[model samples]
Target: MPKNSIQFQKSFSIPEFIQMYGTEMQCRERLFHLRWKNGYVCPDCGSKSYCELKSRPLYQ
Candidate 1:
């Protein structure tokens, strides 16, 4: 491997991961950001505006 090669490792613990994404909303938000790094954008209509369902991890 090259000197500049990157190393992959599991640095975070389960508790830490849960702390960051312990709830449905938290998990959804994290996934949203990962999928849309710039911001939230509608996949169906291509709109930037959206509303979250109160009882579920869904966007409308």
Candidate 2:
């Protein structure tokens, strides 16, 4: 292992991470954005139009 190789794994402290993503909605939005960089698309039919399920954390 190299000395600087581990630098790529650097991360924010616990407090800072919580301050940035402290809410359920914030975390969900972040995940959504990361998962769909070009906007939401249906994995089943290859459609871009879809709606979010109210009672669950899913897209339909």
Candidate 3:
């Protein structure tokens, strides 16, 4: 790390973060996975869901 460089620190609780920014489901999903870590079943419908979202960014 450089002395002149700055690093931003996260200053919010998990729940607060979810509420502050994120799609409705995004936060819940993240929390669900974090809590479970090992594995977790769907709360709404007892179905197994993927932990990660399938996405790819095209950088210029």
Candidate 4:
């Protein structure tokens, strides 16, 4: 190890991480893919389902 350097000798799980940070960028990417994976789209027909109240990390 060196100064100001970090290391990890293990693998990482993306799904586990998404569960941990759903409101994070990583989760947002997964959510976008998951939503479109099944070919589902929201036309924003006033249901407010696509509404994002803030600057979310994954909403384009």
What local distance difference test score does each model get? 0.83, 0.86, 0.61, 0.57
- Backbone clash pairs for candidate 4 read none
Q: What TM-score does prediction 1 earn?
A: 0.56
Candidate numbers sorted by TM-score from highest down:
2, 1, 3, 4
lDDT of 2 by residue, 1-60 (tens): 567866777799999888768898888888889999999988889999988888987799
Pairs of colliding residues, candidate 3? none
TM-score of each: 0.56, 0.70, 0.33, 0.29
Per model, state how many residue pairs clash.
Answer: 0, 0, 0, 0
lDDT of 1 at 45: 86
Give the residue spans of candidate 1 off by over 4 A: 1-8, 43-45, 52-60
* Candidate 1 backbone collisions, by pair: none
Instruction: Name the runs in model 2 displaced over 4 angstroms.
Output: 1-8
Better of 3 and 4 by TM-score: 3
Model 4, range 1-60, lDDT digits (tens) per residue?
455434555646987765756576666667677777754356554232454456643332
Candidate 1's residue-wise lDDT over 1-60, tens digit each?
555434554467999999879998798788889988999888888999988898976778
Query: Looking at model 1, how many pairs of residues clash?
Result: 0
Q: What is the lDDT of residue 54 in candidate 2?
A: 85
**Candidate 4 lDDT score relative to the true structure:** 0.57
For model 3, residues 1-60, the per-residue Cα lDDT tens digits are 555433455578888876755685676667666777877666667666645545742111
